[model samples]
Target: MSRIPTRHLGRYLLQGQLPRKGCLASSNYTPRGSCRVAASCSCSRCLQPFSPQATRAVHVSTSSAASPADTPIIPLRKKLKDEAKQLKKESRKNKAQKGSAQTVDGWELTVGIEIHAQLNTSRKLFSPAATSFNDEPNSHVALFDLSIPGSQPLFQPQTLIPALRAALALNCDIQPVSRFDRKHYFWWDQPSGYQITQYYEPLARNGSITLLARDGIAPEDGDSVTVGIQQIQLEQDTAKTLAQPGDARWLDFNRVGVPLIEIITRPEIHHPRTAAVLVRKIQLLLNAVDACVSGMETGGLRADVNVSVRRTGDTATGRLGTRTEVKNLSTIKAVEDAIIAERDRQIAQIEAGGSVVGETRGWTLGSKQTRRLRGKEGEVDYRYMPDPDLGPLLISEDLVRHIKESVAHLPDRELDELVDRYGVSAKDAVSLMALDNGARIEYFYNVVGGLGKRLREAEGRTPQQPLDLELDPDLKKYAPLAANWILHEFGRLVTDRSSPQDDETAFEITPEGQCARVPVASLSELLFHLHQKKITGKVAKELLLALYHGNVGEAGGVTAAIDAHDLWFHELSEEEYGALVESALEGEDRVLKEFGGNKKTYPQGKLMYLVGKMLRLGPTERIDPVNAEKAMRSRIEELCGTSA
Candidate 1:
């Protein structure tokens, strides 16, 4: 390279396609060396990269979007957020360590529920004696139930039907090969030393029931949640244990060997309200099917709820936090309190960076928090085995189908049908379905159906297609009216007047069971008289009350009460009643005199109202408003001056 100018040194000059020396930017640099410039190169005054006496072209470098310094040791700001959160948590812990407490979300509660219902039976499961609640101790206990030496169980086919119905009602798949097992759990009341249950083979499996927090919700509404049924099995109930605190626990064996159907739900409930609602649903179902005399306030039917909780996103696919069991929660309020306490406790542990222990805890009514009882154990640890003494229950296919057919009506389905067919609102239908008397549903159908048929015959026409009560000429007007009376007025009579238990003991017949106890012929006779307007609604209420109070015998029944108590029977044929109705028609002079003196503008409604008022008066000093109004209307319409 020619030393073009003394000023050009240590700088590359662009030549055709070869490297050429450029003007010298650094006075102390040489050209033949590698492209390394002086590390300390700078403009003399500015102290930046420059050389004296050299006009060098510079390519300004742009900064990158990121840098190694800017990037975290890992990458992204999520890590920073997480670290900050962790640091805050640690600070809280340190504060707690410094004698100041900090609260946070910690342990999660998990819950599983086991619901037991007494099966409807004619005789005790393993006994010849009767199966009755509230009976004297040992009264209903057979030798087998008492677990006397060498005694054995005798299967009852009738007892199994209710259990099967329950399983099907829950949408469970009935297992063809379910077997019974002996579950060992010691209690003072367990005469047999073991509970006969089904662990390996359950009667039902893989089922779910929809639960609505409040009533009247549609099944498809997301507000309704599904609760999974782990299994439903038939078992024998233990005897009642009456405890005396410091004294010995007295065993009352009357309930021993009574058939029980146990329903175990999977751990799906997350909140307290959901738990309460689930319990109510199960109880209602049992009541609806007449399977159990469930008294939530009492222990006739009991619920065991297990609860637990865990950190959110603790798992890759998050499940609920680990839970603890809240066992034997009899009251809905108690269940609510237990869930709240457990949830708070779990969240606190997790937030404190401490692990929560899963265990069975009993809820204290006064303290409102659960105390640990025993460590959580899995099902296999229960050591369930087949009962060696009892052979496998072989229910024939015919038997299963026949049992299914026997229960022609399912409450849930009937409830829906009532809503759709009768044109009844959902809420009204729910109330009808909630009636403790299962027969009321049938009674309602018969009342409406029979009345509609009579009306159709009077009109000389067949009932309309699809038989909509609202549209049918005979029934459209009265179906809802009848439903209201049956659901409300009649229901009140049944509830307020009926004794809860029989006279011999405190055990009363179940409302649904009571319906079965009533002779069908007697009920039909009562309804027929009422439909003929032979009795007023007031008398009907008294009659029903008398019937509910156990007054029986053809002459001594409700009809007698109606006779003795009715104040309006004397008004049935008052001479003044007819005069009042006729006066009401004549007083409408405007109608008869105005319509070319035609009766087209007749005050028919006012006349009927007056008639009804008179009919309501007591017979002794009363007038028959109904008969008066009817006579007046008939006479007015027959007048030649009136429109035909």
Candidate 2:
């Protein structure tokens, strides 16, 4: 073997080509187009051993007939003329371990995301396979999903509505004419070997999502980052593949042909924290619009993250470092973790006189480094073409207008209403809409509406006004109060851990004894009683929990439920109050030692607390604490010369 001469390694990356060994001054350098792809390594074409030499690859010829400048594929080093700069990055992470922190100028971090949202449609995109989870494996597969000889996929017009709804909510420019293409790939999950997707012309494009700065992001630096949405396309879900005992592979086609909307974001996210926030915001929006359930635990929603780093101060401009594509991040937390880990890996590689290789990587939940799945060269070999089975989708004008009317309340809009219209505190508003459970939020409105009606009825006025209107003065007092109880106390009542009385696996239930949920109307009525002083706050909280759990038995209605459970506040009878006052003033002469038979030395406030405590042990009674104090003071004065 000839010893290789040392040289600056910039010529290997050009025209979408990676030099297998040439980029890193490898001892084994084969000229381009020399060999077949490696059997085990999974490189697209290069047979050389997988190395850590990272750089962008665009292969060009030095032939006299072809001009390198004509291709617009000029290597990045040519523009900057900095071989020394490429050799070493700022190494700020290492420096920060010492005392001083130095800001690394000229390096920019860029991130893009591809989100897969399972469409909440009745049937699959192409086949009539029932779109349900946990069904028998392969039970839901249709002939079209398996690509039978004559079976063809038929488009469901109803499924198009949901895809359009998400696109419109994202502020995307919906393309009236979009066509589907076939993405060819070989995997155990995809029996059809090609995925039907809108790629050549996607469903929507050129939209943006705005995320508020969070996780201690300083306002002076930037209060928010608006990442760009590149496109939103409708696609078909593939089957799930499971690795079994003895390294065996199992295929479950139950999820095949399920509809999905793929939202691709631009390389706008700079920080890992920002990427997490952006994905969370999009997930909430998808939930709000009913486009996806956004349940990472259930595999209903997932994201593919594209993270790249550059050497520029502003994230807006720079020649990017090689990026690693972290695939199939099921959780938002995992996305953030993977990005940070990949970034650190790239920075370390560059610092250690190696380049960051662009490749497909996987993340184990607790691990910090990404595991390589495949190289960038192999991953990009998915040859795409127009599908002969499908035609261009023609979205009518009426359809767009109708879909727009359907999605009236989105996450941002609801947050605004909670603060501006309902007078909910801004901080409280965010927590309310953060998850974007439309049903839960809608129930909140229903409960508020019920409160308004009940208050108006009490005032002997018609309860016909719109609940959206500023409620009657009587009900207005409970707006913030009710929100506090619902968001905090009542929320805890339903979602918290099981009590001693509850079963280990607690699920939603109702007081009716049927497999039903407690009605929002009933909860509102309970709150109404609390607001009107018919029940104490403590009674109200217990009452809500009682109804939520099975503690309360079956009843006729909301009022009946409260009465049946005896959750109403009880006022102390005059006899009980007098007896308590007498006991405190005259103590037990035989059993009580401290302050026994010493009425003149007893504090009036202590006597009142004793009286209240005795009452609390029995019932939460309304006692005019102030008047009780006054009466106690008078009684003490009458009994003793020194008590006053």
Candidate 3:
């Protein structure tokens, strides 16, 4: 019998093919009684029979044939060099195509926003310390906030109300059984070494906000987009780290352990402007529901935006490109600017054949650019674990129902009311709702309510009588007028007060309401008189300014301001109006020569000049412009002896 060489046997095994039938042993061979072989063996090298112990000793071996010594091997350094060369080649190709219009136009942007809103609760999430915005740095800190060794967190149930209200307002599905987890991290601001948050299970999920065209955030007037809410989780806010001169950094633990609700949105936003609008909408909604303090300018609301770009038709993985997160954006403008800067950065990187690194970035307002902050951390890096000290946060169905019932009118619904019921233009409605965190809208509503009450009293009707502002012509005029005054004129007043000079002082409002600077009652009365034609538009503006400045003295409201300033519109008798018009045209030969005789081409400028003359002629300066213009036109036609 022929025997196989050890090298040949090993080669065959390495190749995963069995050896030939007779290579090891003949199939028909029989073992002698004393041989003790497991099977038959016919080989010259088999001096001893195979035993179970010997079978175990058999080793799987590799032959030189599997990997020859002549095969070329690349060193790690050389391999890296080759990779760098390939990257450079790709980068060159991308740079060559970068200038192509097609390349620039084919890219699409995707953005996801994660907003952290400080809860409007009085106490901290897990401590008894009070929650405040501008309090003394360390004054509000509790022992737990400082992370003392013996301190344990005592959960505050009251903080859940605002969180639940926010979830409901956003139309999120509340999780009946949610829990908190410990997100492990080390930072100077985080004294506890781990943040208590809802990681494993969030408080709510699967919500959506529909950005309507009328909301002024949509791409076009009639187009609308729906942004999906991924989840809303409750967490503890980290302390504020103040960067001082040089390397000195101070931590304000007052903010530590403060309650926060983190709202994460799906990557549905495409435009930078749209992302900003969505953030503004969220602010409006939260403000309307009194959910959180809801002002990005005040650090009550902060956002982290994840932005990515890919070719329009690229479907290789049916997934987005690598994303970079812009963290801690504190303003709506900053949110928009950051997304734009990050989106452009990714596009430029990709077009230049460089890949977008998944990392964290920050917006430098001065430069209007996004700068690298740190590499993005993964879930494993956070080392999330169920919080042993705090058990599962079980929410009762009754509580949810109560919260749902208590949720105030959301921004969208308020917008609808403003447009449909209040006769405000869509543009005006959006502007009104966004002002002062929806406080302007509340002020507008109060003004309208006051107008309605005054109208009811004027008509000798009771409060129960349904007085539709749309149906009542006099009352209907007040809606748009009030909207204009609050949005444009009143807004200008606030801006002027807020920025009176280069070094501005913060303007304080009365405790009555947001419109306490110009009391709503005063504004309502002013608008009412304007609508009634009792005061001219010019007089109304003057009164509005006076009211805002507190120049309107005690008790009489708009009337008092009007009387003190002698701003009441006086109706001139026909004779008195004719005499004033006649006096303006008495000695104006140049005006008559240029504009009076040509009735076919009655110059509007000439008519306006005459009207201005008549206005200046009046001592009180309270004549209505419309009435003045009419009186002047009639007198001019008589003088020209044609219908001028």
lDDT for each residue of candidate 3 in 218-323, tens digit (9 for 90 to 100): 3432488999999999999999889999999988888999999999999988777778888888987887788875588888999999998899888466799998
| lDDT of candidate 2 over 1-644, digit per residue (tens) | 96543332334443533334544223344445544223233344443444457343322222322444465676666746665555445455554532221112345566789999899888999987788787788888889988889999899877887799899889898898999998889887788898999888999999997876432222322877677899999999998888899989888888888999999998867777678777777777887787876467678888889877655653355466677899999987898778877876776677688887889889989897988999874424778889998888998888888888888777877777676668777666665555334444555566777777787777777646544445444444666666776578756765675766545534443222122445666777887887777777777777777767655555555568667767566666666666556655554333223233546556545656655644454333556454445555555556543344
Weakest lDDT window of 10 consecutive positions for candidate 2: 97-106
Who wins the lDDT comparison? 3
Better of 1 and 2 by lDDT: 2
What's model 2's lDDT at 30?
A: 42
Q: Over the full model, what C-alpha lDDT does candidate 1 score relative to the true structure? A: 0.63
lDDT for 233 (candidate 3): 98
lDDT of 3: 0.78
Model 1 ranges with Cα > 4 A deviation: 1-110, 212-223, 244-248, 286-300, 318-320, 331-341, 348-355, 363-381, 406-408, 437-477, 481-644
What lDDT tens digits, residue by residue, belong to model 1 across residues 282-322?
77677666677545665767777776666545535566656
Ranking by lDDT: 3, 2, 1
Residue-level lDDT for 641 in candidate 3: 64
C-alpha lDDT (0 to 100) for residue 410 of candidate 3: 73
| Candidate 3, superposed: residue stretches over 4 Å from native | 1-104, 218-222, 315-317, 455-474, 497-516, 555-561, 572-623, 627-644
